[model samples]
Target: LDRRSTFAAEVCGCQVEIGAAGAMGAAAVVEAAGGTALQACDAAATVFQNIMGSVCDLVQGIVEIPCHSRNAALASMAFLCADM
Candidate 1:
């Protein structure tokens, strides 16, 4: 998450906090479920691919608008991955 936040800030100029949490947490859950390293990474990458740019760039440019809900959805994904 730290690396992702740094890279996104330096390169993409965005926070991407929830995204990092969702992807990394999902990967951790997959690995905890006995998946191979590659499989875990793939699952996390799939989650990122699905949600990376979904609700960002809102007209208001404040995180409170869509970010909270997006974070909730990401948290749900994390729990779902854990369950799997």
Candidate 2:
């Protein structure tokens, strides 16, 4: 987690001039699951894409629909894929 957070912060700082929001927590979990920094990032992007694919801005409000669960599943799958 710590390493991820640092890497995220560094990336954000270098790229966008802003501090990272959830990079640390994300990084920690990925690292704990035995992912390298590059792999973790790729996995994260896959997870994000999976979630975003199902998200919708409804007439009443923004809704995730099936994206949240899908993202979680995809994240795990991505981690496994990265390992391989």
Candidate 2 backbone collisions, by pair: 1-28
Q: Give the C-alpha lDDT of model 2.
A: 0.43
The residue-by-residue lDDT of candidate 1 on 1-84, one tens digit each, is 464345453353333666677878888888878888887777677667767666355556664666677778888887575455
Which regions of candidate 2 deviate over 4 angstroms? Answer: 1-26, 57-84
What lDDT score goes with residue 34 in model 1? Answer: 83
lDDT of 2 by residue, 1-84 (tens): 245444342333321111122233345567888778986676555444433323233434533433344445554655454444
What is the TM-score (0 to 1) of candidate 2? 0.36
| Cα-based lDDT for every prediction | 0.67, 0.43
Query: Candidate 1 clash total?
Result: 0
Poorly placed runs, candidate 1 (over 4 Å): 1-15, 57-62, 79-84
